[model samples]
Target: MANNPNENEQAQIIHWADMTADRIIKQKGDKGQYVLASGITPSGVVHFGNFRETITVDFVARALRARGKKVRFIFSWDDYDTFRKIPANMPKQEELKKYLFQPIVDTPDPFERDESYAAHHEKNYEAQLEKVGIEVEAIYQAKKYRKGDYKEQIKLALTKRQAIVDILNKYRAEPLEDSWMPLNIYCSKCNRDKTDHIKWDGQWEISYTCELCGHQGSENLQTTSRAKLPWRVDWPMRWVFEGVDFEPGGKDHSSDGGSYTTAQEIVKEVFGGTPPVYLQYDFVSIKGRGGKMSSSKGDLVTVNDVLNIYEPEMVRWIFASYKSNVDFAISFDLDVIKTYEDFDRQERLAYGLEEGNDKKVAMAKRVIELSQIGPMPTVCPFQPSFRHLCNVLQINDGDIKKTRVFYAKDIKNERDERRFQERSRCALHWLKNEAPDEFKFTLNRTRPALDLTKAQTDFLNNLHAFLEKEWDNLKSDKELHEKLYEVIHSVPEFEPMMGFTTLYQILISREKGPKLASFILAIGKERVLGLLRP
Candidate 1:
């Protein structure tokens, strides 16, 4: 993981974010201000698969600011992109088919809540980003285009049409014709891009015949509201438009002959602008679903879905913990519990409450610094075992308020109480929703008829007798745990597993559960002895 760093190694092993920021400043030169950009086409619901780009830029932006560099982080919603297909998850699938080939911004909202399909998806995601502490100057391509905001850029692209073709065809198996223009003109009449037989009249005027509605007209490229550059041209064109210093792309765009390859050439040769310092980020897959997520498929997790299980800080931690180029999975499976545990460990290291080698401490501090949303605490944040919360919440019958009351004595401060509240809510949600059956339990209403061996029966009987008589003497969970172990070894052939399983089955109707001694104490000595008595 190359996570830790020694004093000498700190300079050598910069965090991926700080390293990337350094590279950007070196490549672009130290300017008064720098622009970092990201974007996605709102063709459907924006899933966490797309959030990778947004968070990558945010990390770099923070790193740049840490070095006292002025940073402008902008995210674009390419809502003006064509609606090529109806996603399977959307409603009115059959009706939406008729809207294909139009701008996504112009399509009907399948959910019928927002102004258009693009706004519906875009607005929801913008709010989600704010929840996780990412702030960006959001540029909506549809609104910009409809307002003719990019007409000047469009005119520049039209002037370099042939040069753009030359760069693109360098990688294309077949050549693009000289007559090919660098723009798509949506038919102003039908408002659909289902048009062909185009002709560029050389200067700020292009004529096209609508294949769908049989309309023909010349659009003044100098003033038209429907002109759009192809992805390759638009990508570089915008780099110049916004003076972008850094941007990250997916593996699809970073390949040898991918959009980025040609875009770099087009930016330099055609647009006379340098390409941004670019990094290629790997894909995010769902655990147990070993494939890339697609918005069109809708079989993917969103940022909200993750937030439902993890606190806002933990959400940022998961993404910041990974290098941008490393592929990772978002787990809604058992790994969720471990993820929480790992973050809590990082918190301990960051606060110096837990000891680590210098390198480990440095890495943990950096990750915690990046992962935090508000001010860093002077002390260690309260550490809660996510697995314990699951057990405790279930033992409380999933009443979060009641569960909070149980942990109130342990919470010493306002911050710790908030931590407990957030974590318990997330834990209960997971236990009820995504947690696998093996991790879940319920107090048995009546004991299951168990065919217990004599040794198992004797172990339970002895433990029951001790708890019934000396329960008040047990001062702490750890002390009770040792006492339980002492009792288990007293009976001959009463293996530790045999005794533990016997008690678990009699109480929770499961062979496995939370740590037996701690869980028994949590269930209360009286309640547990009621089940264990012979």
Candidate 2:
């Protein structure tokens, strides 16, 4: 990730989304609308790791629309996939364990909320997506399969089983058995995919014996939902079925022997549809936690988790800021302050409110264009200092109302006020939960009695007098800072560092803390005078 926020304008900037859209337009030719596709199996919670895939598609869809192309975003929920393992995060682990090998849509919700376990995760994530401004024509695989919407495709996969096997064999190090079929089935009796001895007639009927319950049954592909195609075959089949112009895959599927490679050949050779233009995306890791997260392991963060700490636009910025192939971490650590600062700087440069390298400014325009949750506001959005907000929120003891009042004058419009309120919530949440210990503290109710050095005591007396006399005249942090510096330097041989250290110790009982000037103003001059009184 060679992402330099301060990259010089002479640097050539090529946004990945624009490149992908261009490739699709060139490869597929312009049509009335482009169908962009993404999907995942709802076997476990759809954590933030999985979000990289969908948000990648969302970015390209936005880019395509930016190029005057109509775009339809389709997100398929592969709910008909089997419940290979229960997620560690879900409730009722023992209750869920029994449903293993069953289609996820057939498994009952352990929470007993939605009709099925798959629906529980699916619906929750859908709501989370809307918060981040992603809308999709959701395709539920279970319903489509049950309604026989893919009847002709199902028969086609069966008819082309040998060709599908040959395509898959090209990627397998060891050869697949000649009898391997391109399909899978849940037993009619047991409703589990623990079936063996699968045989498909030359026509529409398929028979399989349940290895679990020992029941042998045959069902017509036209009428039964028990049969489904394997992943490699199913993916390309749907690409043709939906006329997808562009789709993106994770690194796993983009490798030489991966699903996307084989599916490209299979779609052309077996189903006779051209594969969609594809981009290979990398994984997103949680900061300080190495490696990709697993929903099955229940150690992953969700979109909701990210949204808890980030404003909606900030969430959009995290993904849009980087190319899909670039691996990045979502930090909940001190790096969070830098993340907010970076976003603010980009927003400033994009609105021409600040100057920057030409390349970065150009990149900021498109990136922020994609980052927005609504239409681009004519004026720049609010760019509050997240670090300052953290300090102010602590001064107000996490009371958002009081915190909002403190920044009320800085805000000029309803949008800025809304931003203040939202970012205040994020700042407060960070301070309470994710911030470093030194970054968090409340104002001392009463002054602390410390054995002060004569030099430190002399500086504090001067500082106290300066605040008392000039507090009412100090209009901004910068002005207050300059006047306070005069008081410290005026004392003979009093080091500026010593004066700052004494002030911090007297205020927060620490040698280091937030930017001093604004922090004092945020604390109010009268309160500082009370604390400085010896």
Q: Identify the candidate with maximal TM-score.
A: 2
lDDT value, candidate 1, whole model: 0.86
> In candidate 1, how many Å is residue 236 off?
0.8
* lDDT of each residue in 216-285, candidate 2, tens digit only: 9999988998888888889999999999898899988999979999999989988899999988899898
In model 2, which regions exceed 4 Å deviation?
1-11, 289-291
Backbone clash numbers for all candidates listed? 1, 2
TM-scores, all models, native as reference: 0.94, 0.95
Off by over 4 Å in 1: 1-8, 445-458
**What is candidate 1's lDDT per residue for 1-534, written digit by digit as tens?**
245545568774468899998999899998879899999999988999999999999989999999999999999999999999888888898889988999999898888899899999999999999988999999998878878877888878888777888788889999986657788889988888877777877677789989999999788876788889888888898999899899999998999989999989988987789999999999988784457687657576889988888998898888888888999988888999889888998889878888887767777888888887776677776776898888878988998887777677778887788788888888988887889898889977566788988888889899889999988888988998889889999998677888788888999988888898778877776678778877
Give per-residue lDDT, candidate 1, residue 75.
92
Residue 196 in model 1: lDDT:
78
